[model samples]
Target: MSNTGKSLSDQAVQELVAKLKQAIATGTYQPGEWLKQIDVERSYNVNRFTVRSALSELHSNGFLQHVPYKGYRVTEHSLQERIAITEARELIECAAAARVIANMDSPGLQRLESLALEFRDALNAEDRPRMMKVNFAFHRCFNDYCRNPHLSRMVDELRERGVGNANRGWTKRSTQEASAQDHLDMVEALRDKNLVRLQALIHIHLNRWRQGYDSLSS
Candidate 1:
């Protein structure tokens, strides 16, 4: 393949990886569900090489587990593992709150607020997939302000790892409402440049899903 051909192939693989990750995160692919390469090829209409590469990438990212003969399956975390991930998020996101606030300008703040409202609208419309997408966009915009690409990438990876388990809590209407409010309140904190309040809100928001998961488990 030429360099341009390889580039297109790489892009195709990355896109496939993202789509598969979203499917897993949204429960379209249940935990422990096997993902056969041939089935993926048929469903996605991609070549076998692309399917293999995409699956390999997801496996490296902790989104899938590979078995020699049986193929790949979505990874499932236990309660304890999920709690550890939540704590990691709190530590990183709360610590980064000040930086996030410092980097925000009026336009950036408006974008954040807009995304927050969009998330609420999705929630009100009971569009679970849209809600999830907007919620992710809201956070991604917020994290971009930290001005540390490596740190932002880590946050994204951690979020993807825990989203599957956290989604269980997101099913509750009350939990969803609280989360929507949390996003707006977070934007308010950014506008006011209240670092402490922002950190507190971040902690609370991160724990909301954990609380829901706990309630369900108990």
Candidate 2:
């Protein structure tokens, strides 16, 4: 059956997905927490089928695992896995930073600068989803000069995997300010063709997640 035009089923699944993704990202579900169908059905007031469908979406998105006999649980990334993802991201992003700097243009810079402002506004307004959306777009602006579609797609996939709950760190005002500064700093570096500074800021920007994850999981 077509669940089009905001059907009740589609809304349920969308709400479930957002809540589950936020829970998983913020470590509420933790690694290996069994996402019992009954629990989800009761909690979300959805049928078993809707819960299963929502879970399948999470599984496809690398947030959950469907084990042979254990059904579904939150996916766990080993230390090694995390490091590998971080390193791959750093490599691609740092290289892209250089290219972005080289190809820096007025229109692109304005767009990214505007996005940075929007991100700050989102944070100040406590709009988590908009903040994340703007932040992702800001970073994607830098990588636009990467040129290779395959590499860009890889970076995009890695980003999708690396993103966490936008609401997770809203209470940390200092961290948000620091991150906003980093984006503004990146824009400055691009305008000035300061590759070294741009690269350093990229590392700092990405390291926030690594450090936060380590602290949370450790």
Candidate 3:
């Protein structure tokens, strides 16, 4: 085994994490394929320990699954699994959104509305990556209203995994458009101060995530 020069720096680990995430999400590394640490180190010119740490972080954040001695694979949760996870996450997220509606000041509401517009522009222009990012930001803004740090952390874990999972399934323009529409509706619901409508929209939005898997495969 050859030396990898030095161990990866903390900043470098974070950068690699983002790079590996995009590569896996974009299918540069296919779902369920083994990721060898030595290969990753060689490919990235990083230390083996760095590769392991990076993979471990991704696994914890739910982007990849560790297969014991078999190493890790980019996660590809089943439709049923997606449904279950979405159901669980929607409860926490919707509750947070309710709090957001109650507590949101003008500036926060403006942020959501801005994100919704960005989401629409991304979709109308067919910029999928930007669309996904804005989508994350929209919900994350609401989650901030929940206030309890512990609950916020719990929701964040699910959001990371669930959003990344949904990214895999979004391959159709119609599906993406529907997602963009949900963002628009969510912003309106916030602006209107309609708690019931907002919670319902949140449910439908979560359900739409599963729809992408069906839409793409069909």
- Using TM-score, give the best candidate's number: 1
Residues 1-218, model 2: lDDT tens digits:
66574597788887898778756644456566798899988887888878988999989888888988778987777656766776889988887776677777999899989999998998789786676668778877778766667777678666655553323333367667778888898889888989999999988877665434536425
Give the winner by lDDT: 1
The models' CA-based lDDT, in order, is 0.89, 0.75, 0.75
The candidate 1 region of ten consecutive residues with least summed lDDT is: 209-218
Give the Cα error of residue 78 in candidate 3, in Å.
2.0
- TM-score for each predicted model, relative to the true structure: 0.90, 0.66, 0.75
The order by descending TM-score is 1, 3, 2
Give the Cα-based TM-score of candidate 2 against the true structure.
0.66
Clashes of each: 0, 0, 0
Worst 10 residues of 3 by lDDT: 1-10
* lDDT score at residue 125, model 2, on the 0-100 scale: 95
Question: Which regions of candidate 2 fall more than 4 Å away from where they truly are?
Answer: 1-63, 68-74, 165-171, 210-218
